[model samples]
Target: MPKPANDNTRFLVADVANLEAEIDALLGAFPDLQEDETLRADMLEGETSLQAVLTRLLGHEREAASMVTAIKKRADELDARKKRQERRQAAMRALMLRLMKAANLPKVPLTEATVSITKGRDSVEVLDEAALPARFLKVMKSPDKTLIGEALRAGKKVKGAAIKTGDDTLTVRAA
Candidate 1:
């Protein structure tokens, strides 16, 4: 019998979940299985369903990773183009400023916009950091992860900190 769209979708989801749970159970049984030992398809209910599902999932993972790489490459290209445009605009502004200063004009009026030359605000410049007094310097402190990890690994207790072990990650590869 032909199923409705929603029913078909629900069935597929439940089926995949069941397949995953079966695989987990099979792996859990062989905690000390050696590399030479083979897990046959007969271990699962369906003959080759496990192999098919694993192949599909691995292919999807690789496709997603490729998409991310392409997106980052395009973003980098756009950023470089934007920076070049900014540098060009700055250069044009500097040329206009030089011309106005040479002609002794404080402001110039245009149909679209008005360009003006104004005195910049006063500011302090730091020449040498070592020569500065303690009052003028600022100190910042932060936790060191490397030292904390070492302490935890050596069985030393650190206040307000503890190491956590996460679930195993699956590595997808072409075979």
Candidate 2:
């Protein structure tokens, strides 16, 4: 018979706890069985529940380890591909910038689009905020909390910058 939709979704918490406790007790009694010789002796000499559970757990552990290794290898491959793509993009941008500098005309018209060598607005890099001109230190970004954050760290009360709580996330691993 087919099970209900939520049947698989439901957790057997108590059952898992009972199994864990039983496994722990069994492990405590047969600590020496962790060695290959002792374990092989127990496994070969008896057809028991402990043997079955241990075998199942070991198989699951191996499978989990293999899966984890495969996933990490895949992720590393993806990261390498991303880095290659980023390098290509950067090289293309550099070539475009070189072409713009070489052109005599600022506005170069093409069939589909226009490329302009327009200069971007100059951004001020504050070396010393205390020594900076008050007029120049005016708000460029609305709700800017950078100054306040610095001031707060320097033992001053700043309205915008307060230490906020960090976020929490789950970390999964094999048991």
Candidate 3:
């Protein structure tokens, strides 16, 4: 199974855990500033220190986010390159199969590689679905949602379908 791009990362850097602990201690030492806004003006020095700590934490978060974006971009580039390589490989495999078939050989053993061509299952090509034999077709029960939506959109009375607008959502982002 393929793992997701956003897997957990273990970035070995400065001891952020210790800094977080110190920040927690500072907050614990003066819980009044957060709970009581009036205490903010009174404890000007403590407020300044808290602001600095918060700023540092925010900066660290921004740095980590930027790094994540960079990693995702790099991963996507590598994935695209890998797919291109796989396509080239498939192309070579196709060439090899054609060579083997043209030479009327089931298998050709080269010095560096071996080529083999074998028969695959008979694939069905549906030229006209209506003209297909009963054995080639399978009947199934399903709803035609498109037709139902069209009927509802035209204000026609559909027994099992109704037209309702979707809800609106507000998106928040950097200006």
Candidate 4:
């Protein structure tokens, strides 16, 4: 949902893909180098012009192998996290449907909910239900109005607008 989350997934996949491509390129190039080396060694064992270059390339190949190993491990971790997020999104969708049924409203997917509250000049960003310290902020309310009534009963100075849901009232407060 957040930009960082999306970017991270894309980056992990790209990293793995790039590493695979590099490995394939190295293996493809190795065979030709192998034949050249055998010919040169037979013709002139002690003096091969390509020996230094070959040594450097082999060192690079070893370094690339280490990098690829690390990338593979990181890719596995990202894959697991991606799967977990998919599961969470599914569960949240189901919960939203149940809430809609209870409220007797047409089912709708939950979009990003924004609420404003007191904040210091240096305050960094907005808050959300997913990142709240508590699941929901309990607010007293009457049947007259649900959302605004809950906000009025919160007993805190309303700095600005707030969003209310069946389970949570997200009111931003500055640190």
Quick one: best TM-score, which candidate? 1
Q: Candidate 3, which segments miss by more than 4 Å at Cα?
A: 1-48, 122-175
Best by lDDT: 1
lDDT of 1 by residue, 1-175 (tens): 2242366455655667888787676667755432334444345535437767666556655776999999999999999999999999999999999999999999999999998998999999999999999999999898898999999999999998899998887776556
What do the candidate models score in CA lDDT, each in turn? 0.77, 0.66, 0.69, 0.57
Q: Which residues of candidate 1, in runs, are more than 4 Å off?
A: 1-15, 21-42, 45-48
**72-151: candidate 4 lDDT, tens digit per residue:** 99999999999999999989867766666677766344466532222237755646656756645566864545655677
**What is the full ranking by lDDT, best candidate first?**
1, 3, 2, 4
Cα-based TM-score, every candidate: 0.76, 0.42, 0.50, 0.37
Error of 2 at 133 (Å): 14
For candidate 4, list the clashing residue pairs, or say none: none
lDDT of candidate 2 over 62-149, digit per residue (tens) = 7667999999999999999999999999998678778878876677788988877768899977788999778876766565567766
Q: Measure candidate 1: CA RMSD.
A: 6.1
Candidate number that wins on TM-score, 3 or 4: 3
Q: Return whichever of 2 and 4 wins on lDDT.
A: 2
**What total of clashing residue pairs does each candidate reach?**
0, 0, 0, 0
